[model samples]
Target chain A: MANIETSLKEAMTIDGAIGVALVDYTSGLTLGTLGGGTTMDMNIAAAGNTDVVRAKLRTLEMLGFSDGIEDILITLDSQYHLIRLLAGSQGLFLYLSLSKSRANLGLARHQLRKIEAELEI
Target chain B: MTSGSDPYQSVRDELAALRQQLTGVRGCVIAGVDGLLILHDSITGFEPHDVAALSAGAYGISRTTGSVLGQGAFSEVTIRSKDGYLAVYAVGELALLAVIGDSGSNIARLHLEARPVTQRLAEKLAIETSHPFG
Candidate 1:
């Protein structure tokens, strides 16, 4: 039953977590956000990531498969962007932006999962 | 709205049924290629419309990557998170089925259950488009 604000704060605590948001993949909207400043805009990041999610879903339909999205990861030169869909919550997702230099991919994924489990909405 | 005469009725019905079959899954949504919701079953706190849009966006990116790599087409895509996973499967050429769940969920089982539903929907769409009475 943890609120989104709590979740966002917890996500920031992860080593190297630069910013995080609970984004609506459908509308490309940031439902909640924390961290990220100056050079990074959580809203823009969420909107741009919408394309990433849409592209993967489209490719699957063209190929004629039956399945659903689990999570999406984009690795940049100096950063890592993670888009994780909320299980049982249709259009909600957690958009995590982390610095590659300081973030542990494995641990970040683990923490995201934990946060998802505890996330109330 | 034409009752039995509506060509998309059967297909829509099938999708609804598929939604039920996937009831145990977390954050699952059935949406059209345009990202419009066809059917969805999510936890109380989730928003189906938002997920559908994200699914559409993800599908779009995947298509571009496929073209760039010279891949023929994509059937499915999975993104693994630290604590869970997001999976999107194609149901015919115009629809997508997305699921978000814990890493511990039986992905193999989910895929198996969704396969027949996808195939059936594809066939139904093909028949409707090809037959006048369908």
Candidate 2:
């Protein structure tokens, strides 16, 4: 039961957070973003990642797969890119990036799941 | 080699070859940025005009998003469903390559295969657009 900015702030509290964005996949727009304004282009990341989510959903639909995506994890050389589509909110998603060396992967995922549940919009 | 007087022949041939090579591919279309159908070789039951319109709309949004964020140009955009994938690749400035492929398709491989064909089509379209009478 938290607003977008509050939810984003809570997300950054997780260990080794680089950035986080709340994006609308339908229009490829950022609802809110935090922690990377200094160095990261949050809007661009949000917009581009919409394709990633759209691609997965479209792929899943074509495969005739019934299950929905929980989250998508892309492991880069030094970072982990996590895309979590909201179960309750259609066309909305949370995108988070983490430093691989400092973040506990399992714990971060668990925390993200909790935050998603509590997110109001 | 001399070019065909019919401008669309090579594009059609390339599309047909793509369908044959990619076992999982269902259909494809090359459309202008304005959502106009330039050439299409989709299977029966699939509507290319609808796809052309949708792809153009999606691509337009992506490009606008990119510009607002200062990310420059977007090379491609992909959409997936339960049974397959749909992707649109930027072909020069005139057209886009939109494809529909099944779940079993190796997507990265598909992109690799599609790139060269996209380049050729782009070049041809660039020529045709610049010299519509010649």
Candidate 3:
């Protein structure tokens, strides 16, 4: 299994990846981050996105959907923000931002899934 | 002697008892919703003030998210780090509780023990606010 650092490095190799972070949605803390230098602040984004994840989870609970989430996608005009829920972890998620013009959504999703599976803490 | 009117005597006792009852708990802090520290156990590494403030911000966001999404209300949030866990719970409409735990901490036990503490503290805070001069 790939470690967190290795997996993050692999994610950067994806087609349109601009930045990526491993976040704990429970506490709104970013464990590790890569890229997103001048364009975005991964730390702030990590905390902000925690609200999104918690809101969705609460909705699912209210609706009686016990099945967990796999991922969430937020598409902006110039960027695609993908949040992949990691399995076997406590409220951990992988957040990736992509340049819409350069990214292939399908491929990026597939790659991120692979990375999530291989990621070890 | 510090006046017996110290509003937080029971609150302090509750925090101390929580630490004594649990293993791996590093520290605990009680703060106002405005991010002001009310009481804290001996916490190392990070500043309790910073933790209190950030936890307030976190609580506000979570509560709003819960309400706006029709999920009712937010009760608590738990953050797991590489080395430990940080959990924040709403003490009442006006305050919050933040607990720091080590990696080996028993989270289930922490929740079981901490939840009741919040309730008792909430009641105490309500009384304190209603009788500032009592």
Model 1: residues with Cα > 4 Å off, grouped in runs: B1-134
For every model in order, the TM-score on chain A comes to: 0.93, 0.95, 0.98
What lDDT is obtained when candidate 2 is compared to the true structure?
A: 0.84
Name the DockQ score for candidate 2. 0.03
Model 3, TM vs. native: 0.51
Residue B97 shift from truth in candidate 1, angstroms: 35
Q: Write the per-residue lDDT of candidate 3 for residues A6-42, one digit (tens) a residue.
A: 9999999999999999988765667899999897988
Error of 1 at A116 (Å): 1.2
Supply DockQ values for each candidate.
0.02, 0.03, 0.02
lDDT of 1 at B18: 54
Over all chains combined, what TM-score does candidate 2 have?
Answer: 0.50
Best by DockQ: 2
Off by over 4 Å in 3: B1-134
lDDT for B72 in candidate 2 is 93
> Could you tell me which 10 consecutive residues in candidate 1 chain A have the lowest summed lDDT?
A46-55
What is model 1's DockQ versus the real complex? 0.02
- CA deviation > 4 Å runs, candidate 2: A1-121, B1-5
For candidate 1, give the lDDT of residue A86. 87
> How big is the positional error of residue A98 in model 3, measured in Å on the Cα after superposition?
0.2
Cα RMSD of all models vs. native, in order, equals 17.1, 8.4, 14.7
Taking the tens digit of each residue's C-alpha lDDT, what string does model 1 give over A16-97?
9999999866545577989898889787677667657766777998988768787888899999988888888567789898
